[model samples]
Target: MKHLSPKQKASIALAALRGEKISKLSSDYQVHPNQIGKWKKLAEEELAVLFTDKRKKENHSQERIIDELYQTIGRREVEISWLKKNSSLSYPERLTLANKEHPDISTLRQAELLDISRSSIYYQPTVNPGDIQIMNSIDKIFTQCPFYGHRRIKPELKEEYGINIGKKRIISLMKEMGLNAIYPRPKLNLSSSDKQHKKFPYLLKGLPIIRPNQVWGTDITYIKLKKYFAYLVAILDWYSRYVVAWKLSPTLENIFCIQALEQALKINKTEVHNSDQGAQYTSLNYINILEESEIRISMDGRGRCMDNIFTERLWRTVKYENIYLNEYADIGEAGQGLSEYFKFYNEKRRHQSLDYKTPAQIYFAKY
Candidate 1:
């Protein structure tokens, strides 16, 4: 009738099992006779299970453990075999490992396991040998005629090299190479404009650039590399055609433009700094630097390349004199080649407009 320990219950049940009467055991243990009967019934039902054979169950448990161990060993073996096949291999070599002819693994599954794209497994890239020659010819054409758009370039391509091509394809290649006509055009893509940034007026329109520090103009141009293109930003002294500072970047980020500005300011401070309406020049950071230096900020009117006339001319001179002369393999190679070229440009190359005087001679005339 009251709470009883498991030991007490088991003892009562044992007495019942030993042929002792449940009513006598109940009276002896102070438990109800009905409670003793319930305990005895439970023990009798479970006693058979306690004495039954367990070897079969043990053997079954052992077999399951052995199966799991075998599965783990198989997984490790597959991993080891894969590593042995692909160890220390290059990406192209590893790509050859995915076989569509394999019986078990499909191409998709093999690609996923190899951490590569399924398309890459089957897609073979073929380069058109004529593209390089055509691009080089295009570069020469663009260098000679900066104002030629894709419409004009199409004919020039056919006339110059007999390489007849469509307008759309030429436009795509020009876009990729970052080339556009230098004439006053509606859309300029080299530098994009952000609607959020502040736009400034063109201040060099009537201003006389009499000396080295009177006005400095900056612009970005694309230099063709062996495989791709690189962007070059330069700050030029308008009056002397002296390159104050130049930076080459793989991107069109404002940081590189700002760095070029910083470098120019370090060399000599100009009274006015001019650039296109491109976002790189109008960016808050670029504006802040010019404002901080007390230099007047001037931006070309939208679609006006001549607003920064000296820099545009500088780009032409750079391409014809140096860029077109050398085949730069990479950015580093281009940088090195451009460094020497700019050195020659500033120190040795004489400008007919500058009375045959070099930029260094004019820039450092007073010094």
Candidate 2:
């Protein structure tokens, strides 16, 4: 039999799916008609598995049976080995016996059967020397000077530690680390220049927010981890500082932000929902969701810090109290920390603006 690379197999499969004649496809693709015919036959056989639900049903049953069998064997083998010998079996001998009983089983499958992650099988201490040093410095500086921007931080690094670096590089690293200055008010970051999307004005400037649903604020913030970063979007009750909904994503894509808004709307529809003029918030898809919920749309004025003060404060509290205090090694850790902090912030932490009451207390106490 002639061997074909994956690329050749893919082309043949695609041509077969398109219903191209074998002779013409072979001529165009520069392969023999016999080879094309064999490829088409293989594709037709596999294509049924792709579209048909039978394979999935059979696989499900097979998985359950395999799991039960493996568990039963594992439990019995330990007792059998103890009873058969006064001394324990060697490592290789134990492995050999296990493999003989389950010829098709894999280590990964065994781990899954035991309800453990593959990473737990081979544990290693993780220590990134460079990232640890950078993270330590960032935590110290962020704690000491919460209001210092990247421009100020760059100069401080040079003067204090003699580590000369430019503002752009420092800013990029800060963004990656999810560190930003806690301005007295919100400073719009990375506002969109796309003219295709219509921009809304800051509607709550003079409007009095007396009730819980009168005005809602939304914003996206960066969540940093040792390995990667995630974006968080939250809908907040502007009047009460109560969080309605929130979501985290591995990218700055608009889908997660939209999902958070959708979840918030499901709970209760607000009269107005406000956000900064970032592309994710300003995209037609995002605005349509709010408009469809019959909620009026409002946006922050460009470069104005006071436009979204409530949400800005939320970000400040999250960074200072939770994120900066711990080293999040991954998204899961960051998410867990945020979950705990938001609960405390909404249910326990007293705010001076709310007359020394928590957000949830103020939001519900009024209504």
Candidate 3:
């Protein structure tokens, strides 16, 4: 007999079901009546299964489409991560992609995965440059004495800078700039009030950092731009004084802190990650990242113990050498300027502490 497609066989089966004579149909199609009878009976027996199989095929197709979508998502994530590490894309641009809404992952977590900061995610170039001169004066004061709160800053602004800004305005601007007049003393302390959460004690008081990734320190500081101001968060390898990752944001949010952390972890997860008890470090999102990685969490006491001293020293270096010298025009210019600065800092600028060796040299060679 001739080969018949399922459709043709189904047509014949339907004909027989409609009371067509089995012998007549077989004779017309040039097939035996017995084969015709079997086809008809089999089709009748599994008619329901045919409908079921169509549904199954549709389900299979849907699953295939979903799989393709997942693969596409995965590819995009990889591309974004690569761009974050390798591209000329600014810090804020990298943060923008990584800091997005996700169902399972928090935006902060996404920022970390992309290796960008959360604060940078929403940074706008629009400058409200309240008082550029005043803010710069404030920057110098805060840089000199970070322990001075707004109340103390107001007096210095009047006495030293000859600006009589109110304390409230100073408070507001300091808050806007993410600069808190850290009480007690500056340069190695912050407060976290989580009594239930396990807080590690200050681990780098007098201990000598022997290698890269032995203890990683992170901190946030304000950056003075030409018109507007921005905040900078950086992670440093304490031993080598290497800036592992750094980001600048218009505000002081923890996501950028998380982003810096994420970038550093990508290179090498450190044994201990140290920071002040600022909201960012104390945040559940940030804590979880370190906790999950099995990294020891070290927090400076509220008093004076020099928790992240290496990172504090870096801020002085960055400001004195690069940030102050350039006076970046805007966030875009600032981003570009800082990028070049960090590159030079890591690759070119030799440190007196490291015997005139660059951070990259000590971080890569001896370790």
Candidate 4:
């Protein structure tokens, strides 16, 4: 009949848990026998809650540790990619590093981290003389008429250069050159949608570009070299026609595309960023970056080359004004030459469409 403190009840319950007789515990604590049983039961329940709370805390700690480890891995991978892109590490050294033992990462992942082609690790480069002429012809025809697909390009080759080549060869060469006809085609409905890559509807249609960074377009083009050729990926601000950033890579590898995108984002964030439905743009890494910044991702619908007309025009301007006029001995030479020309194009060259104002002028000063 006496009121007991929680501490007394808990002490009685613990004594019961320790295998002391319930009657003796009740007598010792001067509590009712039934109340002793109740205290013991309550104590048992509380003990379970305590362990449940401990497990939850343990799980949270484990999750935090896992997240930190993943962050560390991500940082390491980013560092490795930066070194591969900017550092003067030789291919063999990169290969060695990629192949090095890492508990959390695999060789394939490490190769991706290094931006080195896994096959190129052992394969040596040899010049195929026959491709030189054909590729050169393809480059010219594509530049003159970008909308020319392999089907149309085949005929142009025969009529213009009198070189009759099969459609399959043209297709193969175009694929190797990473050339896609700049025009709309029927969308192939996939059986299952890729959750990782979300294909966005073309958002630029009927959208007027009244200011800079309203819609920035990016594209890739073939940069011809004497012995070997490389691809150039560039980011162009649509309204101002400003070449925000550009990167040259020896292959149509997606890494360069990502690098250019990151560089452009760093300099200026656009409201609606447009790119052709290239794998590079649709990549999860690329999409996440844009989405995280709250920028809209717009893809040029197939065959809607005009959707990215400014970027297409930029390629023409770059090639006619600089690439063709200057013969590049190597990738380094091409990068250097294009670097200077882009500087001139952005800083000096006047655009009739821009009301005779330069891209830099319009972008920086006007709008």
Each model's lDDT: 0.75, 0.66, 0.72, 0.73
Residue lDDT tens for model 1, 121-202: 5654343546667777887897778778888989889997999999877876665555667666655376557889898888
User: Each model's TM-score, in the order given?
Assistant: 0.62, 0.58, 0.66, 0.66
Which 10 successive residues of model 3 have the least lDDT summed?
A: 185-194
Q: Give the winner by lDDT: 2 or 4.
A: 4
Error of 2 at 221 (Å): 1.6
Question: For model 2, which pairs clash?
Answer: none
Q: Which pairs clash inside model 3?
A: 117-256, 118-255, 118-256
Alpha carbon deviation, residue 192, candidate 2 (Å): 2.8
In model 1, the worst 10-residue window by lDDT is 21-30
Question: Model 1, residue 143: displacement in angstroms?
Answer: 2.1
Tens-digit per-residue lDDT, 164-213, candidate 4? 98987887777767666655664221111244667888998898799888
The alpha-carbon lDDT assigned to residue 29 of candidate 1 equals: 44
lDDT of 1 at 341: 88
Best by lDDT: 1
Top model by TM-score, which number? 3
RMSD for all candidates, in order, please: 26.3, 13.8, 19.3, 18.7
The residue-by-residue lDDT of candidate 2 on 1-367, one tens digit each, is 3355786577666776788655434423445667777777887887787667876777768878799899979966764554355224321122223331345454434432332222333433253555445544654565466567877777777777667767776766665544556553333244443567899888887898888888998877666566544567788998889998887655554656765776787878899888777777886667766776788988877655358778867876777788778878765566667777889989999999988988999778842
Misplaced by over 4 Å in model 2 are: 1-150, 159-162, 174-189
> In model 4, where is the ten-residue run with the lowest total lDDT?
186-195
Model 4: per-residue Cα lDDT at residue 130: 76
Report the error of model 1 at residue 218, Å.
0.8
